[model samples]
Target chain A: MKDKQNLTGNLGALVKNFSNLHSIEPDSMLDLNTTTFLQKLVSKDVIDAGVRVKPKDYLKSLVLLEYFSGIIEGDYMACKNLAKISEKIRKIEDEEDTSVDPHERDSYLTLPVVIAEAALCANEKEDTYSDNASLKKIKVRYQNHDMKIDLHSPKSKKPEPYYDMIGQMVLDVTSKSVEHYLEKVSSRAELSSLIFTGHALDMIKSDSQKSKVKTALEKKDYFSASLEALKGIMKDITISVIDEYISNLEG
Target chain B: MGKKVVQGGELLFKEDIIIDEEAVRMQLTIPSRIPIFSIDEMQVFYNSHVFTLTKNSSKDAMIKVYTTEYGLNEEKSPKLQEDEYFKANTAEVNKLKEEFIKKAVIGMPDNCYDKSLEKQACLTLVEKINHAYDIAEHSYKAPPSKGLVPKLSDDSIFNTYIGDFERAMLLDGKVYRLETIQEYLSMFQKAIEPKFYKELEKKSVLMTPEEAFKELTDNRHKIHPWGFPFIRNKIWYNEKSFKIFLDGIYWIPKFASTSKNAEEKYRNAIERKIKTDAAEEGFGK
Candidate 1:
């Protein structure tokens, strides 16, 4: 019990440090071995003290902790899904080319993608041992490595006690999405067309309206004139475009 | 015949005398050897019917009398009929009345009755009234001129009221010289007007719509609706004006840059460049 308590305290401190660093750059690099360290801590004998906690909670917390720490690649399927989306955005921006010097464009694109992906995976499934098998399968696919994930393996006999952890994961991902969007566009006009379009789309109630708003946004009419139109349609909506997009992906 | 009885209007023993008391009556004849006295002595003799003669051998005899009448009488005494006392007393009373009228003419001067001067006059009037009461108890009278009197109808009216002394001295109309009671009232009215007008003007200006709007804008965050309704509705539509307004809103530090980090970087670079240039020019030394 004492060991688990110490581990929880350590996790909290790590989360705080990660947030502080994340604020400096939305996609700042983090230590790669963070998951290994977390795994080791959870393996302590005092982990039995966490028996009352559902496995879903524990898995959720682990996923959320990894997301906030900027440790996107992990054994969990949710973490892997988030990483895949981040990779796609980085690939589009050509962030991994060592020959290319670091630039604002890469950071801007990668940060939003990572945030969106994390939020989506976090929102999808609740934690269960059966879910982990599917999760491991997704994670293996995400790695693009030779290791195979066996979904048909015998399920664990006892119910895990970490469902609360999954809930935390969703919260963390949502927060990251907001933080990243704010980092990119502190000013209203600095918002990208994709984000703006997403927001405008969210405002639409019907398919026709969605198409119309999308068309208006694409033509850059949204910046020049469509803000009032958008306001009229969605007077009560408070979420920003990027946030809405991330939330949709998560949902 | 021990001594002769003399009367104010008669020579010694010359006049026929009659005496009567209760039921008795008597008459006597007079000797006319003595000369008739002067008119005054005769008047005295008539006034006092009883007179006494003091003997200094017969050659130096003197007569004296007591009289009830002191001034002109219609009958018996001809010399006392003149109206000198009446004329003298009336003249003295008239001279005193004229002096009282002269003292009542205190007031502010013509040039001193302007807007600013009116306030000063009010204060001065109050002080003078106080002083007047302290010195003269009964004789002090306030000025009668309406213009000179400070207007106490409304708060601002008293601002125009001039001092009582100035009114008494300078005002052309009837001087209602400030007496004890009126002086105190003038002082109070004068003192209260300026303060009242100041407060009234302040309230009027503050209550104006422009002032209220300014106050609203100052504490706007507290009262601002969820959204900037004015900007969203009225100001946002007009292209040219909206652009200017957006520029104004977006130009603030929080929203100007794509990110707060970018602004900090830009500022740092600018500062560094300025420092480098200064060093090159030997200005830093």
Candidate 2:
């Protein structure tokens, strides 16, 4: 009877602390809301306990089944805190105009966000890998298209770097003839034009323009003929025209 | 050996005199310009004594020399021997042999006889022939007449093929290239231009403003959802109603102008209405 009373008092204190932290007004909420609030309160307590614990020590403690089980109710809080961190990072990113130096900007922020989002969104959507094994394998559908890519990595892996590598690998594999893939992707959307990365655009343009130059060379007019065909490959234009020109050259 | 006298007017002859090797060598040294004879008819000659070098046997007529022992008795004289000097003249023979071999090398066939070269030439020739035949056949089939065929120039036929404006252009001495006009007719014979123009005129005369509004609504499906509001509002305006509501306005103006005794007043009014409506719709003012 004494122990039960002590547990009730601790729970009341946790609820009070959570309400204070989240700025939620005290009210009679539903069971799920109450559970969520308790989870956030417990997660804060764990963080408070780990204030002096090094990140490595904290991560080691998280690896233990006993420690992780004790924190099961606080997983939502950890996820929310991570989301808040990501939001803050995003706000900082938006303050600076990075359009002019998109590549450098993307390297700085997009890669990290892409990595975090891959894991976070996957977890949120119930698409996370089931195994806690070293190599965690998952598949994500890109752009709601038929293209599904498999990602595999160790559980101890940082999400950002892993996703960045995966993204680059996909780009490399598709780069050989990205125009063909882009055409298919755009057609599925019933679009006449598509905007892609500058590199992809340049590649397609050069490929098409080179052929046009070759044709001009065949016609014996090399002077006005341009080899610099793909200057603005990344810009939007009627894809059918490019496709027709390519087909005409091939014929 | 004693020299014997011949009868008057009879000539003394030597065995090798009739066939001189030197004369043969001279003739052989001259290169033949005729490709056919040099390639096909040249003969090879061999020297029996000098196995290393072959020469024309008919040339080199120097008589054989002999070494004699003067001490020998007349009765036992080494049975009149032929000369050993004929034993192959190695240096001269080698030189002649080299020259003959060089000439033979020069006489060898050229590389033009390869299969690919022959095939390419055959293809080119065939293409040229086919092109020439096509041109000739087309010319023969459609020879240009001295004057226009009366049947071809009939207004009814013109109206049946080309729309009113095109017909007028044809009759008004403005159109060029009869071949182009004829080709178009032949290509699209089923698409009678007069019938199309008449339908357009009927639509213009008969369609009501309400009906045009209904049509614009019906055609909304053909337009993008984002573009629908702009087009709908443009045609809905009262002042521009006639111009915006008319069906086939794009074709009617050209055909109406071609009508005989068409009044400029109606055209001007129509054009003004069209311009006003176009301006409202954000087109040309």
Candidate 3:
């Protein structure tokens, strides 16, 4: 009972602090956060006590408070406190003398765990997406069609232009094949001008593109000519596009 | 506020904790330009790796129990009495990882081709295509084309898979040759042009072997690099990032699988096993 009182007191303080910081009423948000967190906790089998104050409310309040406080004040301890509180709950659950599953225990790390932990607590439907513009500064988002989650660092001020170099074409502009280059430019222009006339090509457009394609084909640089043709039609030469194009051709 | 800790019988006052700013900044940050994967592929990814790392093994074990319980009789489910659940979970995780890795290949750029490394490149590309990745495997079994004639269907089929993408990019793993790379690139250039398809339409069959071979022979400089299609989905994690993700799984308790009530099921299974053993011992006595 004493432990439960302390848990409630801590939760209340956290709720008041978080609500004040966000400049919003605590009633509704607190309820939603508590419900979400509680459901997750129950599913995990972390709560062993028979009759109790909802431990998830305390966890949710602490998590929200730590998250906003860490970002806004840059006070790292606020985040650490969230972990400590979780540890405390685990300890409480463990004291019940029931056999515990090894997988149910909390796994702790020094640094990167903070981001994933914060992300786990993030509710997609909540106001965190819209109200907190600073949230974008962090990399935590539901990715892989919202099936997987990932987190990374924010962009720095450096002129680091990032690109997914894996499946993209690397166009070379510096080669000294002036005649070949001019031929490529002309062929590219010809291929690009043809309109998408449904899935199959129209006769006239097909004839024009094919002639340029054949001329390019006759030249030593068939690869560049093929790229121009695909890029012109697909508007982008990506693996997925190529795959889809092939699928259509096969069909 | 500082917290006091008794360490080795000496009381110590702890000050503010400093987060490793450098470590956090240096995380394997994938650029956003990477194309995201389809949902089906993402499902494959989660079923393979994430479930094990995130400690969803118990739930997975319960799922096996239920799958066996409902699909087959419970008599056949427990291969072993003591560690049956653990063994089942581990086996599934290992099998999935192996399956996924077989389909995974390192990201390849156009610049990966080198004349000096031709043999190695050819071997690696062929190995990946024939065994590891096998992107062309399904096309071999692809149904016949609608517009093309029966006699020329083989050519159309060849054009559909070999002549188009894999042959255009890989050329049966001989991408090291300058001519081969040029031909690969030219194949793509021609495929997009309206005239390329127009020519295809003119033929009763997709291609003659010589024609396909001629088309496959074009080369400019090189072809674009292709990573796995799921790379954009952030499914392709670097080694360090993979460890980080596994570490991250520890902190997110809510991700714990609760749907199956796995712990209860596990405990019940164990109890049943114990009771059965005791009954057998008593009968022997």
Top DockQ model: 2
All DockQ scores? 0.00, 0.01, 0.01
- Per-candidate TM equals 0.15, 0.14, 0.16
lDDT of 3 at B244: 11
Task: Estimate candidate 1's alpha-carbon lDDT, on a 0 to 1 scale.
Answer: 0.27
Task: Give interface RMSD, per candidate.
Answer: 57.6, 49.0, 24.1
Sort the predicted structures by DockQ, highest score first: 2, 3, 1
Q: What DockQ does predicted model 3 obtain?
A: 0.01
- Chain B TM, per prediction: 0.12, 0.15, 0.17
Better of 1 and 2 by lDDT: 1
Task: Tell me the tens digit of each residue's lDDT in model 1 across B1-285.
Answer: 212333343332211221112111111111111111211111111111212222221212121111111121213211121122223344443443333222321332323223343343334433433333232212222233223223222211111111122111000011112121122223223333455434433443323223322332333333323222231221111111111101011100001112233223322322222222222222111
Q: Model 1: per-residue lDDT, tens digit, A1-251? A: 55433333333322222211112111111111122223322222212212111222333333332322222223344344443443444455553343432222232222333333334343343242136674464334323322222222332111111211211222232222222232222111222222333433344456665556545544544332223223323432333534554455456
C-alpha lDDT (0 to 100) for residue B33 of candidate 1:
16
Question: Rank by TM-score, descending?
Answer: 3, 1, 2
Task: Assess candidate 2 and give its lDDT.
Answer: 0.25
- Show pairs that collide, candidate 2: A201-A233, A205-A230, B20-B59, B21-B58, B21-B59, B21-B60, B22-B59, B22-B60, B64-B83, B65-B83
Interface RMSD of predicted model 3: 24.1
